[model samples]
Target: MTTVTLPEKTPAHTGRTPGRPGRRGVQPLALNIVALAAGLGGWALLSLLGFEDLPGPAQVAARGGEMIADGTLLDDVAASLRRVFSGFALGTLLAIPVGFLMGWYGVARGLIEPYVQFFRTIPPLAVIPLAIVLLGIGETPKIFVIFLAAFLSSVVATYQGVIDVDKTLINAARVLGASDLTVFVKVVIPASAPFILVGMRIGLGSAWGTLVAAELIAAQEGLGFRMQQAQLYYDLSTIFVGLITIGLLGLAMDRLLLLAERRLTGWQERR
Candidate 1:
């Protein structure tokens, strides 16, 4: 027993497993940090290399902090968010029924499809001047433009989703004596929901993009207005701040929609 026996050997790679949940979660966070650091480093280098007009990260941070302290940034953010939400809500609400009707009924499709195609071909930005003339250079025009952007983007997706539903499933439901309304409510709607949500995400992006052009018409207090004013003064830092804020806000909203999609579509099999 006292013969100098070595202890039992353990696996050398006995640390965290490669596919562990903790590692999976930490990887994205680590990568995000690294990416942010690299971007800031590159920005700083460029500014030091005599891009005199370009604002460094530090300069942008300082300007943003100043705006935050004076409550200007918050006001702009709130105003922009309000318009986006209101317009997005209006558009999505109206689009879902219109889309369902177009997809579900032949008469609805025949009447509406041509108009939808015509309007959708016209960019929301292109409609801004008309909107201003018709609705006035006020909140109504801006909201209307945003509404069109969201509505057009969503309606097509919703329509296609319904059209793409599994034909077999509908036949099965019919064989089971399901009524038209029952089949639509139980089969079509559930099948098309994912597409509808995807459309909403696209619509949200369109809404944000069109908001800038809409605000350009005559906004007094949104992020787009803030950036335009900064540009007039040649204030690069504020311009960067506004651009970054919009990017980050849009990213956050997109992620939320993705989260919703995952939750709603959990019934689908993973690869």
Candidate 2:
């Protein structure tokens, strides 16, 4: 009894460290902001060094404002956006069902794989002539070009995603009493969403480029048409303006897809 002793317990805060929530996140973002500012500053300096061909950000911004005021820019942007969305929607809608069929059905896969691969190798630009020949120089050919862009990319991605889905997961679903349709709907589709989205992003970019090519061939509207007009007049500034606008628009659309991807795939990190 006299020799009995108890060890002292440590206090909860004795050697504990405190953390600033989200502090790690802020630093990289701050560095990125600084880098962006420095890059813009360097661009401005370069523009001031007699680089007349290199349209400064300010010049592009001014031209953008002028175009907006004249209403042409907005109209072109809207028209281009509409074409992209419409074609993308049509392509993706078809691709999803077809991809699912090709992935799940052996006979369907054998039947469709060759055609899919054949068309996939053909460049969208190369197919422009074919599209025009088949559909004419109107919106049909243009949309078809965009549709091909989306279809090839999205379908391939969806097919690959479906094929690569974990067999274990499928087996687990089956063991849990999921019917084929239920398993596909509840598991396969959700699992393949990321790949499908990536395809959509690639497809959208392709569609934008294809839209420019499409507009180059007998079109009187859109940014590409405006740029062509500017080129004919030797208006380098206006051409640069249109080029920059196209880039900005593409960037905006890409960012929108990225945002959607982040939201849709939020659960990915937890895994």
Candidate 3:
């Protein structure tokens, strides 16, 4: 008599590895917490070592708490947020169309590229004097400089994205009878989305970097202005507070953009 062996059944794959559902989400948050703790620890250590002009984490936190209780912090935050958002939005909105034009049309590129490159060489800070002279010492100048910063950052990124789109994909779309508009809408835009989002993120940073100078245009009631005032009185703690507030705000906004990028470019592969 012969003994017959039967094949064992295997589990079907569901395209995802078996693990705790929230583990991946929790990991990044945990790492971020650790990083924050490490930074605070280093800062505290440095302050303890008598680093002149450097306020410790505890001192800064206490000052921040007082500002928060007085509602001064909130007001400054609101003002700064308003300026950054307004300028950044306008810059990005205009940049997308202009960048698309420059990338998609040779004639448009010829006309616009020269000016774009010209402006790119000049720092937004350099424009401040002119902005104040022309737009006056008002909110207009502050917002204008910020707008220029964001516009330059975003336009360059957007133009690069458009040009960097895969030629093969465009050709294939064309061969499949897709019209130019259709190809642009269906193929080019999606392919270029990652770069555009990255550019927007860079633009956001540039806007914040320009904020201190932007608020210097004979204005008041913002973080940068607060920091400047603090500087006059040698209020290191307040200066630290303003610096930290701006950093936190920028970090939060950048994280939001990062989330948007992840959602929009879900089709792209990653490590």
Best of the candidates, TM-score: 3
Which window of ten consecutive residues has the lowest lDDT sum in model 1?
17-26
lDDT for model 1 comes to 0.91
lDDT of 2 at 200: 84
Please give the lDDT score at residue 17 for candidate 3. 43
Which TM-score value belongs to model 1? 0.88
lDDT (Cα) of model 3: 0.92
Q: TM-score-based ranking, best first?
A: 3, 1, 2
Task: Report lDDT (CA) for all predictions.
Answer: 0.91, 0.83, 0.92
Q: For candidate 2, write residues 1-271 as lDDT tens digits.
A: 3897777644444443344332334587689789989988987888889676676779867877998999998898887777777888899889888888888888999999999999988888898888878888888888888888899998988888899889899999999999999999988988888988898898888888887887866887888888888888777667777777787788888899999998998877652
lDDT of 1 at 59: 89
Ranking by lDDT: 3, 1, 2
Task: Count backbone clashes in candidate 2.
Answer: 0
- Candidates 1 and 3: which is better by lDDT? 3
TM-score of each: 0.88, 0.85, 0.89
lDDT of 1 by residue, 1-271 (tens): 5788777644435555445543435588799999999999999999988787688889899999999999999999999998998889899999999999999999999999999999998999999878878998879998988999999989999999999999999999999999999999999999998999999999999999988888987899999999999889999999999999999999999999999999988987764
